[model samples]
Target: MTLAHFLHGLRCASCGTLNALWLDLIRALVECHQCGQTALTLTDTDEGRSL
Candidate 1:
């Protein structure tokens, strides 16, 4: 089977740490390098809004 993936962005809910995200493994939990916190939430803020 063929696989597809997309890369987005991720932010820490507590410290506001932003990073790249891959849609292929989004279901898998990721951790933040700065605050040592796991990825709890993801949002699209390119349109000018607070996530």
Candidate 2:
């Protein structure tokens, strides 16, 4: 299983629509793009601010 993060949220930069994808792997994350939506690209942060 993949590591789960609370930061599991995708914000459509185009239409500003927030969608949950982590919980749903069957659906394409960019499907909303056809309707003028952008997928929120996630950037993981260090567990303790790695130096």
Candidate 3:
């Protein structure tokens, strides 16, 4: 999936560390790279606003 956005300063729920996350717009998911946490799952409406 192509990355649509890069979200910075996101706190990971699993690791409790602030990290920059890659937003996969096609999948509507935002995941933490540091701890492999699925930080957010966005809906269609939310996806549009994110960009």
Top model by lDDT, which number? 3
lDDT of 1 at 21: 34
Error of 3 at 51 (Å): 28
- Give model 1 RMSD, 1 decimal: 8.4
Candidate 2 TM-score versus the reference: 0.28
Every model's TM-score: 0.37, 0.28, 0.59
Q: Write the per-residue lDDT of candidate 1 for residues 4-33, one digit (tens) a residue.
A: 243347665667767633233445445556
Candidate 2 global CA lDDT score: 0.42
In candidate 2, stretches whose alpha carbon ends up further than 4 angstroms from where it belongs are 1-8, 20-29, 33-51
> Which residue pairs does candidate 1 place in steric collision?
none
lDDT of each: 0.52, 0.42, 0.71
Candidate 3's clash total is: 0
lDDT of 3: 0.71
- Candidate 3, 9-36: lDDT as tens digits: 6676677777646688877788777777
Pairs of residues at least 3 apart in sequence or in different chains that clash in candidate 2: none
- lDDT digits (tens) for residues 1-51 of candidate 2: 444332236664555556633322333234343244424444367655867
Worst 10 residues of 1 by lDDT: 20-29
Given candidate 1, what's the lDDT at residue 34? 64
lDDT measured at residue 51 in model 1 versus the true structure, 0 to 100:
68
> Which ranges of candidate 1 are over 4 A from the true structure?
1-8, 20-27, 39-51
